[model samples]
Target: MSPSQEIELTLTPAQAATGVVIPVTLPSGPQRLRIPPARNGDLVRARVGDTEVLLRIHVSGPPAPAPAGKSGALGCLVALAVAAVVVGLVIANSDDDSTPTASSSPTAASTYTPYTPPTYSPPTYTPPTYDPAPAPPPTTEAAPSPFDTGTCLNGQLPDSTTAQTVRGVKEVSCSADDAHYRVIQRFPGTHDMSRCDANPRTEYGFSYQYTLNGSVINEYVYCLVGIGSYSRA
Candidate 1:
């Protein structure tokens, strides 16, 4: 701002952390700004007073050492003098010891780095906040469909997998959507299927034999009436 321009006082208290909400006044009205916390000696921008101007504020860095008054300086000098006299007396009264080793040493050149204070940028856009823990990740697992273990529920067939042994048939998919075994007929191994075969004949099928192909333990053969084979045509 020009020398004549001045900032109005703010109602917000000083802050030393980020995301502090500062209350400021503008010619338009009073407003709250969420400005990031700044270190001492940093310049922060905020609308102040009854003008359109935004004022640059200097943050106080470290605390300044208290100025030594005249009396304090004199006391410091007297302390230094007393310390020197005591040291001299101690040396005069000390017993002789090994001579100290001396080595030539190089003095390091003093370097000064220019100070660069942090500058505050406008805060980024922040949406409304929600505090609740994120909704528990979806409860379901990538599990085998219920149909994988049994026959179709109602009439909804299970999405096919590589191979599922159901009844006496190891139903296998033949297409993208999958081909399934809808048992058109069932019979005991001891009984003949000659009079119970599907009209078109099942393309592929097997028995539930446990020990051998067609063993008596799983004597039931799940027969398919029709393969349901069809193309886009």
Candidate 2:
């Protein structure tokens, strides 16, 4: 029996009438109790906590009839023998009623691992670098002049004797009514009037000068002729 287990012993009405005397309850732990002599066929009920068991009493020898005159001594011997038998039977039955405790095996302890959040690294911020578009490569091409050789003019030339610079010249188609002069040739980088003498159709020459801060920086010349019914040759 386990150390903490308890038991209860009881007898039926029939067994009690036969004069059985046994402990009604057994508390936890080791204890001792007495069993009164009982008949061979008496039944005792044992309760171990919630379970119940029935135990049968057995005597080794049959009862002898008591002598008619001297019953006390013979009865005493029989009672002693019966008591021993009852005690033995009670012990045997009690042993059968005991429950064997099963040993508990040790269990493996579980290991707990805490969750760790992943390290967060914000993305590095790099501002965009912008360089002003490289200045357009310095233009090597020169600006185009308003008048080109072979073009017709609509206005008269300025009086070369008094004019220092020519202006107000309007180019037109030779077929128009207001067409006045046609340029036969032109000279760049020089304003010499003699350059027009090489062309037979040249009747007038004009010098154009570009000045900055009252000093001539560059010049051009145009050789022209009155467009009197002139047709392209």
Candidate 3:
């Protein structure tokens, strides 16, 4: 094969039933391709362009065993030599006078001290005495109104078209079952109902005007939306 020509080599194992492909390119002169060791029945395939060649692997069996008679005689001679050495050692040890002997006198009993645990005393914990804080003086000022902007109320409007002075409207939680209206926007220092017209969602308008000696002091316009029963008229 030419050096430029490429050969596709495939190896398939008999036990695995799988094929592996390896590319091989031959040199201009003699070249050697090392093939991997395989089982006895494995197959090797080589392809050059369109032509393909398949080869089967053949592995030789193991060598025959040695004769058993010679091995048995050799083992017997080794055992006899070992036995002779053991007998010589036993005779030599029997004549020795330096071996130690056990004493015939009675031994003293070993004394043991009993274990004692250390004494542990629990610490006494004394509760701290604290003087109660004096109760705040009873507040004489009037309670502030709970109704404000963003606060919800559960009440019907006395008049929807004309702005009415808001009073006796206790604020309720927005999630409460009795909540009927929610204050969307509040205009401080002004009681004009037209200010609430900018918000399309405003269904009701209420004003809070406080006067001191015939002069307006504190005023607020609350733009409200009805929850369920009341809607924009």
Candidate 4:
């Protein structure tokens, strides 16, 4: 047989809510009892299991549960019934869809006709011809060169231009000014600059020749492109 007893206890504001299991002294030993939330200074007489308890609840937040115990119990029973009915309906619906038969399978009837999409052809396309924008006009400023006629006429560059490659008597254009060094003039001829034997340390110059050795021989005035050299071609 379960032992029963009557106990008196006071509940703080924190412990007065429903589902709060509070410890109480019993004839057998200390046992925890669950109760609903109550208002401050509320005197409650509720039987928790086989033990009867008189509780004085003090709470600061929400009002206590409805004072009529019989109506509250009736409302709980109605809620449980509604919940059971909803669960039963859900379970029935799930079971009905779990399996299928030949009769339940989708089938086309004699009057049914399959759908046919209309034939479509993309329109013929001819890509347009494209002509890119015209290139920028050629630069007017002439790049500096060895056979600059202006520098040659001005005597800015003379026989002191260095020859990277010497082709006998080939006329070339010049544009850069050799203003840093003095121009050394050479007598027109087809001669290696080494034959001139001019030292660039004291005097800098090279012997250059322009005009092809063909039917008629031709000569040109010399000019300068850089330091320590001349274009006498």
Candidate 5:
């Protein structure tokens, strides 16, 4: 039998959240209870908000009976299902591990052989031909005169008194038809007058050689080429 009188206790903040179950004598047998509002232990689970605060009981009682063969058989069936799942997991992991390792090794390279080109010998060289140049024309210098002579016995060539009586002479001659000859003289005379016969003792003069075209013989037979004092060679 149980007494009807009841007692109540308040909970501290730490004790309330920790689920510290307190068993008190209820004027009957020992009963478990929580602190806040002093609620029944079974009615108020040892939890505060979302947290479950585990609180074990150390009560004196008889041991419960063992499970029957039917319960054991059900447990064995569950254990076999779990074993099958574990084997499947092992096989899946093995496949993943083996496949990646096989593909990781590199493949072999292809073989190659080089081609050879044929050898060539060069042809002999041939040089071009050319003609020789023609020879140059010959060169020659004719000889100078050996005997050329003259003298002014009458002083200078152009005399003031005997200017009208002056005589011309051909002192030289050329052998070739294209060749010709002329004469020149020097004397002590001014530009306006020549002392051709100033004095027979003081007469001093000179003469030079020149040319007249032999091919134009008729046009220049008696032409006076140049005037000078006189000369003996």
Candidate 6:
């Protein structure tokens, strides 16, 4: 590194292999050095006349795809395949040995007990003699449906004039013009009366029908309250 300390190096081709050899000589003096070799981006390690100095080396071309020891995985796979083949061969041989061997000569007929069917007798059927009787005429009219008039007392809105007749927790009223009839009541709101029955009030051309009992009525009341409280009036 100083001005007086000078070193020179030269590279020559080796005759045995396609590799280069570098020879370096230090200045004539009593000296000790741990110096490294000259770095030229080549695939050979630089050495001082075949003497390694810091082992500076460069390798060209792509690295080997797999390392040497990694072949054990492939070897193990091959070994397993071979082992499977060996085991399969062993099993096949065992099966071949275990099976009942066939003989060239025909075997004697089996002396099995013969199966006998039981004798069954058919029964004789006798036909009965018929006596002609006068036939009665069939009833034409269908009997009235017992629950045909099963109308809910609170089912309909009464006419205005007939409003005074029926009174309960429920109220029924109609306009004088008969244009609007409302059956407003706190009836049992257990079911969705609008579509509850096959023949609902809506189906019969009634204005409105609803149940007014239990949780359903409570829900309706709560909804009405909520609407009234939050409505933009």
lDDT of each: 0.36, 0.54, 0.51, 0.39, 0.30, 0.26
RMSD of 4: 22.1
Give the winner by lDDT: 1 or 2.
Answer: 2
* Pairs of colliding residues, candidate 3: none
RMSD of each: 25.9, 27.7, 31.6, 22.1, 38.1, 34.3
State the lDDT of candidate 2 residue by residue for 1-233, as single tens digits.
33323233444434432333344434433322223335555443333433333445554443545548877888788656644332222222232323222112111111112347699999999999998888766545454464787788876665454535556667788788988788778898897888888988777787777665556667878888877743323
C-alpha TM-scores of all predictions: 0.20, 0.32, 0.34, 0.20, 0.17, 0.14
> Candidate 5's residue-wise lDDT over 72-96, tens digit each?
6785675455332211000112112
Q: lDDT by residue for model 6 over 1-233, one digit each (tens)?
A: 22322223222222111222222233332222211211222212112222322222333444224336668689557435533220100001121222322112222111112247799999999999889887866545443221112222222333332213222322222222222222222223222334323432322212222223321222110011001222222
- Candidate that would win on TM-score: 3
Q: Please name the candidate that would achieve the greatest lDDT relative to the true structure.
A: 2
Off by over 4 Å in 5: 1-111, 117-123, 136-225, 228-233
Clashes of each: 2, 0, 0, 14, 8, 3
Supply the TM-score for candidate 2: 0.32
Clashes of 2: 0
What is the lDDT, from 0 to 100, of the residue 82 in candidate 2?
46
Model 4 worst lDDT run, 10 consecutive residues:
86-95
Q: Candidate 3: minimum summed lDDT over ten consecutive residues — where?
A: 85-94
lDDT of 4 by residue, 44-135 (tens): 44333444444444455654554465697785675455332211000012223332211111121111123477999999999999999999
Alpha-carbon deviation at 46 in model 2, angstroms: 99
Query: Candidate 1, TM-score vs. the true structure?
Result: 0.20
> What TM-score does prediction 6 earn?
0.14
